[model samples]
Target: MDNGKIKHIGVFTSGGDSPGMNAALYGTVKVAEQHGIRVSGILKGYEGMIDGHFIPLESQQLQKTVHRGGTVLKTARSERFMAVDGRQLAFKSLQDNDIDAVVAIGGDGTFKGLIAFSEISKIPFIGIPGTIDNDLAGTDFTLGFDSAINTAIESIDKIKDTAESHNRVFIVEVMGRDSGYIAIHSGLGVGADAILIPESGEDFLQLLKKVKDYRSEDGFIVVVSEGDELGAELVASKIKELNPEVDLRITKLGHVQRGGNPSAFDRMLGIRLGAASVNALMNGERNVMAGILDNQLKFTPFDSVVKQHQLNEELYGLLKTLNT
Candidate 1:
């Protein structure tokens, strides 16, 4: 439970892969190696841990990966790990490999699994926020969020060119299973005519009327989050129904937003948080997440990180005001 007692650490990326995961891995490995602590890469997350798929890692192994996209250790969802027996197997693997602690990188589900595993194992764990959804609490901005919003905005910018050329209405759908961060930011960035987010109750008729009222020679652009009740397709259909003369198109960004190299902002955030996780573990911290709040490093309890995050009303209101 102390720095001297910790000689080896296991690191893994769980749940969905994010753009800044590699940077996080690199930072962890580099910091651990600097302290003469051996590092093991747990491939495919808890599933790999239970399967004993530990790979040796050092500072050199992570060279040139800070700018890379996705995770070098890969990631997967393990339903089996939710059970006690699966956690025993993972604990056995950690014990057999002499891993003294763990650094888990991912969203809420990853942290929840780590917490469950800790209930049955003696090994300590630290979490890093690395989801595109930006739904995780404790952190003002999760890793890959900036990259994802930039990616979505770039795609929207291109779609706007075509929408304007064709003189038609274009509805772009972005990813956000339960959050509207992506849609709101991208919509504001692209100066969308209207944005439909799950956080804001849908008003299809009102949206259609807004489009009709905003119609101009430059064409119309609407952004919709995937979590919205009326997705891009449904919203586009309703708009077309309300105004038959208006030409309309739909584009779903899909997983494309999850791809791409880590931006400078994301890379730095990953490195800072990753190193902070190692420091937390070395200082005898456990069951905590290292995050950045207001540009300062802070550690938060896992329970708070998993709690549901409310939508940012001020930002949402700003979007409406800007469009109006």
Candidate 2:
């Protein structure tokens, strides 16, 4: 890590907003200010970069921010930023503002934009994992994952009361269009009778068997990830098709899981990684991501970081055995 030419750095959040993003942003601003590196908040992520939406940042701007969810700077996914000209325009704006380095907080799409932008601009970029999906590689837990699982658990717990009262089967759906971290953890936490995730390879038939096995029970819960190849709706349809006499319902937690104050673990992770990103740039590291691997802080090159697998097989197995 030897390229510390950064005098001023711009920070932004992009892609889907996560609960701990503001905590990370606060960490970056505070640490950068202490080191005498001028800081600017790039509004709406890359769109702000292209549009020149920058606001001077100091510790005061971040006061009382650690307890908040989403990002103080806000976030967005930019299609224009995906184009070469869009990136060039963003670079020109950075130059005009005297920004020398950048730190972005978000998930895979966020990193992809940073990687492409860094390729054409001398200004180095670093990424901080900030999504609740916990699907990205290189880190054990993404910033908002713990908070999201807890939110889902709370919602499902209430829904369970209805299921029990009506003596009906409820197939609850949680987020994870590509990954099942939310489903696996929240389902297990609430002690669902069964859980169905895309990666588990537990097909519709397997789920059908679980439903039947638990038929003697008064009521039961089945947790399903949205990305499950079998699809949650199809699972419901099939169940009703075979067990016509069964009373059933479906609840999709939706964006509600994305809200709520970040959990303690997420706050610590966001602040630590946020500070680490600033340190990494000062140490001359670029085109990398700040990650916590095996409880140790590390800087992984963005290319390799995004390619790593994130599923926790050990927990998945425990969910299956214990829930039965």
Pairs clashing within candidate 1:
none
Q: Pick the TM-score winner.
A: 1
TM-score of each: 0.96, 0.95
Candidate 1 regions off by >4 Å? 202-206, 213-215
Compared with the true structure, what per-residue lDDT tens digits does model 1 show for residues 65-162?
Answer: 88888889988999889889999999999999999899999998998887788788778889999999999888899999999999999999999999
lDDT of 2 by residue, 27-122 (tens): 898888888788899999999999999999887768588888888898888999999999999999999999999998989888878788878998
RMSD of each: 1.8, 2.2
lDDT of 2 at 100: 93
